[model samples]
Target: MRKRRTAYLSGLLALTVLSGCGSSGHSSKPSASPTAAVSWKFTTLDLGIPDKVLKAPVTGKVPDDKTLHVGVTLKVSDEAWKKFGHGKSPAQRAGDVGKDLGITDAQLQKVQAYLNQAHIQAKTSKTRTSVTFDVKAGQAAKLLRTSFVTHKLNGRTYFTPDPNHPPQIPEQIKPYILAVTGLESYSVAPKARALGASAPGRALPTRAGRCIQRFPQKFASSQRVAAAYGFNQLWGQGWRGENMTVNLVEMDGYDRNDVANYVACTGAHIQLGNVNLGATEPAVGAEATLDIQMLAGLAPNLRIVDYQEDPELLNSGNGADSWAALNNALQRIIDDNADKKRPGSIVSISMGGPEGFLSQPIMQAIDQSLRILTATEQMSVFISSGDCGAFADRQYGSLDVSFPASSPYAVSVGGTRLDLAPNGARTGEVVWSDRSSLSRCENQWGSGGGVSKVFQRPSYQQAPGADNRYAASGGRQVPDISAAAINLPIYFRGNWVSSGGTSAAAPIWAAGMALVNQGLLARAHIFCYGPDTFYHALSAGAANRPYTDVVAGNNLYYPATAGFDLSTGLGSPNLPAFFNTLAANPG
Candidate 1:
């Protein structure tokens, strides 16, 4: 009906399955009937928070006076999800994504009425899908059917909800909702650190053509990136990521001077724009600096919209997570127009933490939100598969997977150790398995990957070459792919620093996806957004030259093999062949 982009879909897509990488002592499922409009009197669906989050110990001392700000999510209805699958025009698709179609005015009024009944005031978002409101420790305990106490994590004190029983959803808004997140409020960041003895980067290298970039510095730049990735052939064919826009969410602001200086230093032709999402502190962090530099460095001609989020919301000394900011950013990207509109080619999120530590409701909420992007909006979202190789577990030796990255719809990117010849030519690459070898910090070596103790194996993942050995576990795996994560220099905090992690790897896939979308924005509604052709191409690369299967190294526990393994996933994409395969896409 919609130009049949669905042809690229390989197998049955478990579009409704909601799970994460977190492990549960036992399985739990939230009850929601799609067809039932049950009574409003005692109609409350009890969705319990995961035990792992409740059981996680805190670190900081609780203050005498502390308030709880619970984040609430209203699920998107099934009708809105059908828009992407059924709609034809961009406007038709954006009609809902541009705004929160999850909750109606009537539903909002009901929620507000409930809030008033509880004597609690809520801060509703512009989309009306997310709300942030304050509640006393006792008030929250009664509202969500959970017990609350102050706990410290990472030296910060905040409220952690211990659900003696599952959370309740009012029957009045039952069938219309998907997930209501924000039971816990802890967000993690990119797992990267400085490479010791960072020096001034090398000068720019000479370029043969006008379209290709020129990198002079010893630090990797946009030009050398093209050469190293075997994109030379495509650049000659006029495929330099023009007419594309990549949406990146770093939850932190970046230095304007640093970005401009990187462009000037590298002679890149890229442009960077920012959509401020209520951030008060405009000061930039090193992570933001490196993220922007890497995107512009790879796809120099591509437009990047850095969706800057509220710093207070991002790192609210009270263990605030990225859910609110990410939701706001994604909604803006979907609804954007006039000067702020982007092409919606791909999204890159280079941050994450242990999936199990994240609450189940939050994971489901994010999963449904991503369903809007991948299944509905037809946009590709590439999330970095964390830097920690498995999670810190001394008891059962469990390898924890990262959240958001482990979401079924996301193309999870791992890390790799890249080696270049003296002349800056590619030599060899391996899985970025560094266990205490790269930093004094723990869990710094290899890329973040492992089995999803939460999510089941989606239908698309059930196909061949998706690690057949793990069928017994019947869960999702961490990284679907990987790219360069080591031996590269990035400009951060006024100095050039060498850094690598899964954070560095995600942008590679995202920028590459932008190039795949170049000259095809108007047809974005027909593009394959999920793990369709790209996964096929990656799988083909293994037997062919387009993919380099890393048969060595491990992510703490799982080993890299000739095929799909948790360490390097399908191994790094071979640029020439990978692009060739993507360009040949009929969509």
Candidate 2:
């Protein structure tokens, strides 16, 4: 018989506390014995006060403003846990905790009273399991500070490198902290798991080949735009983004067979390079596969470089390590471009995390990398605006924007939904659902868009519609351009998968950039600005250009209007006419 493991609440709590107290590691609760089972529950709160107050005020100046927004986590005791669980997994146990906690009553009242006694006004309270309430700014700080001075709240401990400031974590409760906050860092076991349970066999190239035929029709509007820009005619003269190199940054790795199928279907000869950034296992994962497939289908001749970074190293939630990987990849691209003396190279990043979650150092690193690309005079970076709407799903709501995309120095791509006639002609078009808005997720498809709380409006964005008054003070305008994202069909595996996200939009734009790079190279103008400059030149070229303004459809948050709006940006690019104007003005 197998040896039975003894379980005690104290021992289990100790293990859990040790595991979760640190910023890293998998979240696990104490295992229950056969006599009594242990489980965890998750919840969220509103914390009615503004984030600026709960957090240290900006600029090291403590504001006299006495407001605080505090969200608290309360662990359910063993008895409560048992009562909540009729015998189910932790995921299933979640549903019961909401009711037992009187999540609608008692917990909420407790939160309100705490704030009221602290002289903090309670704006609102949303109680799930963990309750969030807003109070006067600095109230949280006051409570934390006073707790220390009075030598009370001994069970509460804060963690950080600095003595003066650190985030407080209530003692002996791992489940509550994990549920309410983001993870700092983590490491997975050495053994790799198969990508998924169902591994389908590779099939012949029918779907891939069909994608080639369907491409022109599916993107007829974009093709029309390209024709208006003179891309089709330019390609007629043998300039089709043939020799340029494009790199895609993504999590997980791609399927090798799928990539080959896509290449075969598109009739495009592309080189693929996979760089594992210290992943213990293979780099082929879901995200990687999607990016490679889309990029290859769009620009067949462009060399594809896959840079893989360990998910654990960057903190399991896809934060810091992503920035590190991006910087390192850019450096590698720059070095390679110099080695080959290639005139132009474009980097495409489809993966990103919510802003404000990143440390200042990471943001600086991004700025430095962009400066390098700009200074080298031969490189441009393209980043996805994010699939989550402007606020990144409210949980991280703090006037924050998605980074690298929000960085003023880089070209940020938004999304649009396309409608095609039976023959693939443009029947209709609208702002992609992925555009940043509160309703994005509700629609099941949305692109991340919103004003940036961190970056300021750049000179280019100071156009007629670029007024800052429309946004919260200190916020930056976003989504310089838009492309088809909603319900876009791609050849995945043996069948076609209709997927819509900013993930689809970024590569589509990246492919367009690749075509532009080829055109620039052919015209002997290797070091040029991004598509924005190209579009501006095209807009000035001729009134009768092939470009069509998207005036219908909304991102469900913002409407798509005549010219430029946050929804569709400057509308999808007219590739043909765009190329023509570039040839005309080889600046």
Candidate 3:
């Protein structure tokens, strides 16, 4: 096992190095120092295309022509940073830089002038230090080529890097650029293969559907456990999350048809709203489809708001911009909800990069946003703990954790592999494994959990498994909850498909929360429950609930346990009974 772990870690490191090599060229020098003369990055969206044009590509059709988007990374000199009084704090410094850039009202005017002079129509812009402008589809390439030409704005020559002499981005910013652009793994296309016979057949079961199938049976059993625990029961009749709205953040966009089909399969009447943060370009894979479908499946009645950040804006490779996009989305949701006075809003994010690879400033920004959303909106955010385990790389034997989920304010959802009887009853469940093995029985990708090095235990996590001693001893509890994320067959685009990951678990938990919210409303409660209360309620009924304690599983790097192990968290949901309990308690 030790040898295998070393190999896995080595492989993960190699993968990261290779991934870096494939994209922008690697550099040892810091990309852009806050003190650099031309230090700043900006993102713009391509939006002149009609809605019809946007939807066509999503339907698997090619566009009449190619559309290019240029996300520019800029840097200000150190002297400029001092003149602008950009502070040491990431948020403050970024804010200061944004004020210098077009992120402020004054700057916005200058930016608007520039766009007007260029005959460009700027759609919407996000206000992180990096300001993003949405432009026309085909126009971006031209803008990229010419916009960098020194242009006069606000009586000063706002030096735009000549397209012929584009500004160089520091090596560190590359990964972030890859993440925001949704192009990190763009070099790899979907490897198409036929579905195996053992895979779930077409037409799966819905919570309300009558045609019971094996998959439904298993789901039903899980639901029944929640119901038995009085947790999964329906709340007020006619309450379809009318009072609540949810925001789902993901790296790519999904197949809308597949999402609609999944909803039909589940007999859910949920309405999904798509908000394109990125340009109208479709993400290259299934990440979007799976995330949206799972979220809808779990929370059938809530208003599902989907926000897609401009992939090009992210391609600038600045981690701060990614956080800015996330913050922008959250702020947008908050503003929208406030305008409508909708309480109990929630945001579910299923995407994350490795912890060590991210910059401290960016991490701080993320942490601050999480705290703000949790406090002001009373919004419960869910993040996938990770598909990797404690020793993230079993091949190389390194103990590392995934991020965003590690952020104290967000609830981390873990994964589990489930075994079902012929009748759809769950026979057992274990950690989803994704470790490479010679036997090749199952790939060992399991739940990501454990302690944090950077984050101290928050007050809410002061339960049996959470404490200073444990955290000090490198034992922070992860994945406050669990869901079936291993090899589950879900209906997508009128077909049943099998998929699994911490990605699946995050949305599943979010859907469960939607149901709980319904129950809370039924009982005349208005206050949103905190993570502590939710977990306490879950812990109270763990034994009597329909949970199948995963005793015999491993993430390839670590062994699974009977209860409350990091490998599977608190175990998969007893969906039905859990809802019932929420309805009864209404807290």
Candidate 4:
């Protein structure tokens, strides 16, 4: 999977490109029989779009000629899901496994034919259980029997298939199809879980003196980061994330010059690459910069790939075209890896919104897609839990968790406020929360963590340390782990900034996972890709100093406790010790 050595870019770029991105899924049993094949009529699956969204003011109909890209989630048989036990899949490549678990060849052919009859183009995804296509609005509306209408809600404008009218498919194909998404033409805007000054490509002073003088004790230097997280131990042991790649999911692009400058500034050795799924923003955003810079700083020798998505799909002025970009980007990662084009088993996604905000079909499609990565591809995915603590949606008196983060297969990362001595020894750490500084309804920023309103607790999460108070909720607990999220150093745009939040915390876990995989590959001849390895390691007791449990803080609502709690989950990593445990067991 090695590429020709190119000129060193930013340390973050080089390291990030080498460190791959993450994946997800957990069997949510499908009702469709594996052997059933019958001719039928037409129906619609409840998409679960909120009534508030449905009631929004309709601006107008989407242009008939506008192209809309949609994702179709097919049913997976119970027998296929049974094959994937609690830990891993028997299939070596995720793409090949889909035929058994996802859509059969006959099913794909029938669905494609049906869509073709409507002048719509569609094809099955290599990663399985999904079909994607782009079709003109008029054709899509005619086929689904719904008009696409623009709506303005809460100061934001977007569009969807007429909420009053459900999208329908032929009865013969309904059994094979779970849900068809992208008809909404917009995603609940993803919040980048970070806090800092952001200037995409603006020029600013490169000197560290300015930032250091301004932030004082707030920012941690690269050296401090290494010392704080026990990365020094891994580096001394020759495990600096070499022979590893990390994939970063982003909505924007970064400046190579900025990467190069950061690399030079931090003396980080990193290489970077990009794969654009659709039309992306011209300049970089702080979220993308933070992810790259943090990965570059921690795993300097790792390779990073930034998977950017379409900007127009998310922009305010227009929003009725391509809402499936995130799913497209994720599926692309699985396809690329399965094909050995860019084989990265590690992934990090720092963007997400409340789980409740996404339609049920969209949420299911995303979770099921993630299942392919974690169960089939055996990849590790780290997602920022969110930056708004228990109030994930940021609406007062509401408790929630971020989607994808709440997905069972993903390793949800929360945030912590850490105190380190001059020598980089941890003095103390607490759950990150700005409860006192801001209003409860608007600015109560902190690490996102809570009981999921969706997704049952995966088997791995049923371990002894888990919090069962929310057991009746039947949802997975968020933030399986956490890391310091405050005052982490990042070189963004053209200046050094003190960045923090779960956005900054997620990459730390991703970089650390890269090192863990590197070490495991050397000894076990395999990489620990799924959450099984992490849960196993944490369950190992004192044998592995898995995490430094945070028992002293809260994310506004949930308080950190002795073991696993809603806030901060399993606490911050114990680092090299955790790595050593995984290397020895390689579960």
lDDT of 4: 0.71
Against the true structure, what is each candidate's TM-score? 0.77, 0.61, 0.60, 0.86
What's the distance in Å from true for residue 353, model 4?
Answer: 0.7
lDDT by residue (tens digit), candidate 3, 1-587: 00000000000011010000011111122223223343335443321222222222211211214222323222222443343211121222333223442233433344334334435543332222222343443343343332222233223221222323233333423322211221111111111111121244534444444323445444433233333222334422444344456677655655656665566555555656666655666463455566666655545556777776655444543343455555555545544443233345678876665554444434454564565445433567888877656643222356656667778778777777666665655566667666564232221346777666656656656434344233565434676777767555555444565666777777777766666565454454433444554555555554445344566776555456655566666667765555554444433
User: Residue by residue across 448-473, what tens digits does model 1's lDDT show?
Assistant: 77788888767656323575675479
Ranking of predictions according to TM-score: 4, 1, 2, 3
Compared to the true structure, candidate 2 yields what TM-score? 0.61
By lDDT, the better pick of 1 and 3 is: 1
Top-lDDT candidate index: 4
Question: Per-residue lDDT of 250-287 in model 2, one digit per residue for the tens?
Answer: 55655666666656655556677766644645444545
Instruction: Answer with 1 or 3, whichever has the higher TM-score.
Output: 1
By summed lDDT, the worst window of 10 consecutive residues in model 1 runs over 9-18
Residue 200 accuracy (lDDT) in model 1: 43
Off by over 4 Å in 2: 1-159, 165-233, 312-318, 338-340, 393-400, 434-444, 462-464, 468-475, 525-527, 531-535, 542-547
